[model samples]
Target: MSENLNPAELQKTCLYDRHVALQAKMSPFAGFMMPIQYDSITVEHNAVRQKVGMFDVSHMGEVFVEGPEAEKFVNWIFTNEIRGFEPGKVLYGMMCYPDGGVVDDLLVYREFAPDHFLLVVNAANIDKDFAWIEEHAKGFDCTVRNESPVWGQIAVQGPESEKVLADVLGLPEAANLGFYTFYDTEYKGKRMIVSRTGYTGEDGFELYTSIDGTVELWDRLIAAGVQPCGLGCRDTLRFEAGLPLYGDELSAEISPVMAGLGMFCKFDKDFIGKEALLAQKGGEIARKLVGIEIEDKAIPRAGYPVELEDGTEVGIVTTGYHSISLDKSICFALVDKAYAALDTPLSIRIRKKVFPGKVVKKRFYQTNYKK
Candidate 1:
């Protein structure tokens, strides 16, 4: 606990003190001091998928938008339809540039109050997203504020997460919260927001509470036997679950259509990139993101060359990992759309040898997302 209290001018989260108290390995992440892990990455990753684990994800960005013009402004920026979201529900969507490239993937929280909502975004894209929103909000009457510093977020994930959280937090029906939904609850007389959402494809809840509450909640969850996980485990878990990391699979250069996220785009509603998307719709995507399973013992890695059966270069791997669940080397690659189909055979250039790989389903492991 005492190891991280020195004066380094690094930003700290509400759970920073608690992490230090638990003797976590702290490191810089997205400009904030964060815990990388309490134990080994592989151990924590397995814990979350098989048993129970919790992570301090307060480093994520939070922005609140509310006003009479809120709906209109949000509709203008995001690629999904919000007309169907009821209060206490959240929607997964993306904010994009006019050219149909993603600015950031976000979860929009529909508050109980009409015209009020919260946008949870990626930490690294905070400044850029804020600027983009503000620039596009010139004539709109809504106000946007970056609230990342005011709150701390925690994710309790795994198959056992529901039972453990309910037992520890004394919130019955907490486990019953519908997937992709949120609930405003009172815990220890303090207001808390718990959402059934997470980056790891496992069933989990992302809890938002005050800084003081965050410390207490963390302690309680730990006492309830929840394993403390870190960014490394978080990444591996999401990767194994076939989830995409922002910079790895999605970037300004990759459009949602090319990334197989076209379902999130609401063509019925006009968004910033609607014109570009429409223009490119039905046209062949030059390169597409797909998953590949390596056959040889050699592991495929990011930036490794991908080639066709004839040995012609196609693309490169963007994210790769040795899946503990599948017990095989798996990778995500942006390959020529012609080879994006399932079961397509390809090879990865590893060192001087070519390792055979096949384009399988993008999701390497089955997810436990609630119905």
Candidate 2:
């Protein structure tokens, strides 16, 4: 667990006050004072899976790249192919170091023109990511600007997300968006960006608007009976859906291929870390990320040692939980390739005792993403 930081030093989002009023469990995460949960993690987790729920994701970072060479610059830095990306299209990929270690996973939104692109990154990596991109923009004939402070984001997710936005928020554009797509629209004369994207692995939409607009929209959604969810459930939801968390599933030492996310890496074009990732993809990798299911009720957690029956340590657990949706002790672990095969016997060291387990598919619950 990360040490608790001083609240006075933590940044607050536009919805900070609202979360406080709701008596949420507040914590310092990614340099921001944010809500971890409103009611209980289970309740909030189920709310989004079964009905409509809203999350104050204003802490996320946004950067813009605009110029005649925007496409080239983006393709150069990103692992995904974006050569023919049309406006309103969103691509999920990662930035990597020369050694193929992940810089950060992000979403790239091509807005109305070929020369304009929006990069939404994890809040914790805002400063580092912005600096990295800016430093690399030296000769790209483009400008890089961190627009995180100027924008507030809200995600309305789950099965009833579309209906909630259309009826409560009065945004008909929400219903028209396909998965990984977005559009610019106006609400009460204020410009907003609505995208069919979310972290919860449900059919949902993320709304990016001004700070004031976020406050107003949050209030309206609350009055319309949308459950206000927090970050605690968000982690569990994403984990169950097999979505990777930046610091956990991926990191500066963990490449995309090692984390089982190689499909997003386009090999046809040159990007930072292309050579190393290509070598990793074509040859042998020492360790690979895999899912482990503990037979006992004891929950595995991050940093827990994964061992074989002979008590030989093989890997470490990256993320784990007593899955809220599946009601099982499951986790994602970075283990030796020999131990990553399905049905391979393994043991998770939970406290003093070692629990029996086996490797399984990382997706504990099937996602309901509307494509």
Candidate 3:
């Protein structure tokens, strides 16, 4: 998808110059000229796993919904329940189409009031997600605003993330943040939103600040010896932790149930895709997402064919890699439900060779979330 973008038309984040100064390999991603790697993917990957790393995540989109019907409107559109959401709490879920296909997976944050909420969505689906929300809000007494451009985001992820933010950035309030929670604080007298949330399966925080504040924070972290990470390691880390990337694991044609994300879908509420998802849950689902451990060193990639011993095609790989942390070739594949069970024998076609593999737990490594 990124290959088709014209470099001249790509957007630049506030940290673009900093990335160039560090000699990061910049590429067009999600309509933006973003860094793919600064040093090596392995080194950056280990930095986050062992110590600390920071990411320029300003490309993510943020939308605000505020009104008397904010909770009701959010519940109607999203697959998760938000009945007990209070300020600072966040819920992860997907907005699905009527046919149960995913619209996008997002994090919904309950802000200062029950009538106000914030949504953090994928960068590539920002425009489309906002439009969908606006169109469905026809009869609700609410206000929907896309606030993507007004904020800049940086993710400080690792075991020492909190300490880095508190000591290096001098944001002492960061140490008090709880998992999946956020707090409004001040940095350099500028309002900032700090959340104990991250994409990597580690203890971390995501800070949202003004464009200028973002630049200052990035500089401060770099000066404090925090490694500047790029998207390459980000993918490997998230894959190792079994976190689903939107376009890879969940898509317009892939429902939450098929992606093994049924826990995030609440059936008691009447959501847009409730009927279809409930039916899928109660009936037979044709395919399901599962983990595959390749016996060989060959890496399996997205769109590779999955088959049984007799070469009968079953499904396709969604995301895969030679895991840096685990030192094994692993992949996430969407395959026939019959082959989704643990220990199921399977084969992945890589180039002209078919490599033997077995279905295992999707998570290659245990997450270290501070919950």
- TM-score of each model, paired residue for residue: 0.94, 0.98, 0.98
Each model's lDDT comes to 0.85, 0.93, 0.93
| Tens-place lDDT digits, model 3, residues 229-284 | 99999999999999999889999888999999999999988999999998889865
Worst lDDT window (10 residues) for model 1? 1-10
After superposing candidate 3 on the true structure, give the runs of residues whose Cα lies further than 4 Å from its correct spot: none
Tell how far residue 62 is off in model 1, in angstroms. 1.1
Residue 202 of candidate 2: its Cα lDDT? 90
Look at candidate 3 and give me any clashing residue pairs: none
In candidate 3, residue 252 scores what lDDT?
Answer: 86
Q: What is the lDDT of residue 290 in candidate 1?
A: 94
Error of 3 at 1 (Å): 3.7
Query: What lDDT does candidate 2 reach at residue 359?
Result: 98
In terms of lDDT, model 1 sits at 0.85
Candidate no. 3 TM-score? 0.98
lDDT of 1 at 44: 94
